[model samples]
Target: MLNRRQLLQNGLLCGGAAALSQFPTGMAFADEATRLYWFGSPARAERTLAVVKLFETANPGIKINSEVGGNDYWSKLTTMIAGGNAPDIYQLAPSRFADYARRNATLPLDEFLGKIIRTDKLMPNALKLGSVDGKIAGIPLAINAFALLYDTAIFEQTGLKPPVETTTWDDFAKLCVELTKAIGKPNLWAVGNCARYSYALEAFLVQRGKRLYLDNGQIGFDIEDAKAWYGYWDSLSKAGGCVSAEIQALDKNQIDSNPMSKRNAAMTIAFSNQLVGYQQLAKNKIALTSLPILEGSGQSGLFYKASLHMAVANNVKNPELAAKFLDFFINDLEAGKALGVERGVPLNLAVRDVVAPTVDEVSKRSIDYISSIADRVGDFPPQVPIGASELEERVYRPIADKLGFGLLSVAEAAQELISQANRILKL
Candidate 1:
């Protein structure tokens, strides 16, 4: 196999400007029909690539070279663009999109909306998530949300009533304690060690009507709010509300590898779309429950968001062809069937309706859960700032781990975390 530089050089030689300038960005490759490079994470690669394969079958002239951007996808992708090897279309998360948009790394897609891409079939709210500065920078890939997934068998066996939208945070914690006691397994617990997880943190903040950071890149919550957030989870850990740290430390970020898949915990927090992944590896039937409401608030921590996106690169050779391919990915009935809810709920209303009956029982459940909470979910938080990703590794992860491990008091940890957010965001 060719090394990365060689492979990248080969890609350029095969489809780069000098050779393919004749056809524009979307047409057939001069060598053997046009090749469009699509870079993204491996999280949803299997199902997404299936659709691309079908697209290739249908359009004999265009070939999509799907590649993994690996960890720190945005950082790596930016370097590639600087080196003049940008992918034609790529996956983007709303969190990092603003910085990319500001830098002009991605194409502004407003013009393609009703033309080559029929995003009019998508939910209005979903489309808004991918916009930056009032221009559509990316297409909403899937409208994802946060939820608590419970194993039905465990709840039945324990005689615990399943948690509902009415369940308070205190009530949920008590239920978790009860489940942990009932199971009595060394690794078994009721919740996930959700520290180091900004997604779950976002849900908690949003439930309180806060964002992680303001649109102007300022810290959004006070130190006291962070304290309460840490206190709640810390109390759960002390009460055996989540799996042992040893078990959680082994998490590989793959659904099958999670300790939850082995039923080590009765309940775990997950994105609504991830329920489909968890179902495959879980021995027991898993069901979605609304995130527990905070006491006296009556508001949920779950935030329905357009978590991921499909974006064409600023340098894509043919914008029209790229837009057409992307439209097919989201709006085509066949593509929708192949992708299902692997990337989260389909954002297109037409595609969602078409794939509803054909998807597996698990994916269908995911769709239904997301649909049921559509109105209950809060607004999408602002796009994370340029330093957000850096904060995760250097600042948030360390402080969160301290909270998770009981190495520091809640007040101390919260103060430190908030201080770090303020410091890094300014840098």
Candidate 2:
């Protein structure tokens, strides 16, 4: 493992003439490595490096210079782009994809698909999520949908029927209250308070025939929509159906910190693909199910999205080489085996099948769950508008936290969210 100084000394973290200067004159100048960067936990980074090694071994003479970023990834990436030194291949977040595309930071990949990159097995919705304004700006690495994941052991103990596809939010709340009462366990709640979760909020809004973003790049839903969404969890929390704010605050929403994984809650709202990781963290069996539908509204509002994407820089020095590496990273069976479902279910069906048999029972269940709901999911929503990430992580999350902590009324939280989101979106 290379430390920061070692990475800088090796030129992996440098660029251009400065980077060349870091290496021994002959060795570094000889190989024109296709630089790659991604931001993730250490585990995901290890899996990615394994795939990189596989790619290098399979295609001799083509070296890869890969770097993984930590907490400051987005800010650092912005700096790199501003300085005209972005990596040849990098991970693109769905929230920022359209923003990058509009800024010409990403190269259009329409020319590479089906030629350099295999597309026949890729899910159409995955490709759709990576595209902006009819141009394919990025290639999706995986596909995932929002879901309510619960502990089967807990449900059985309570003798409560677990939530299913057709379960309404009302029904879900009732079950939560009942589950908490029946369990009568200290510190354990029926469900985590997901009012602070942006994904859950999006799913709820979509069920009401509204979404986080409209086609025109404005905040889509209004105060009433947000009010109803928050009110659902708030009312449930008051009735002992959901964990209190203090308990919920212990979870930062990552797999390791999630309430369900911590045994502080029985159920949680998370992506379908996360079941593999969540199950590994839990002592008992965890299962995935559709998020409860809005009562009296026939809309499922479930959507399949690219969990993340791989994009080439618009100014890449070796476009063909970058495409070849991305093709191997995304479509190769060996890469699939190395990555498993860490990134989400593979977007490439053939690779998914190749990887499926190699994964554990929990991962296999994740693959099966995604397949079961794939046909019913709505189309990928509009490209997340610029500033939507800020709206979600910065504005929406804090406001939701405040609501959960009982620092703000439902109407107050709703108003704050809309006003802040609109201001960020410049609407």
Question: Which model scores highest in TM-score?
Answer: 2
Each candidate's TM vs. the true structure?
A: 0.87, 0.91
lDDT at residue 317 of model 2 (Cα atoms): 81
Error of 2 at 313 (Å): 1.5
Residues 113-215, candidate 1, lDDT per residue (tens digit)? 8899886778876777887877988887888788888899888888888898888889888988888888776777877777656767777787777878787
- Roughly what TM-score does model 2 have, to 2 decimal places? 0.91
Q: Which stretches of candidate 2 lie over 4 Å from their true place?
A: 1-32
Give the distance in Å from residue 401's predicted Cα in candidate 2 to where it truly belongs.
1.7
Candidate 2 per-residue lDDT over residues 97-132, each given as its tens digit: 899988999999989888998888776656887888
Question: Backbone collision count in every prediction?
Answer: 6, 0
RMSD of 1: 5.2
- Of candidate 1, the 10-residue stretch with the lowest lDDT total is 14-23
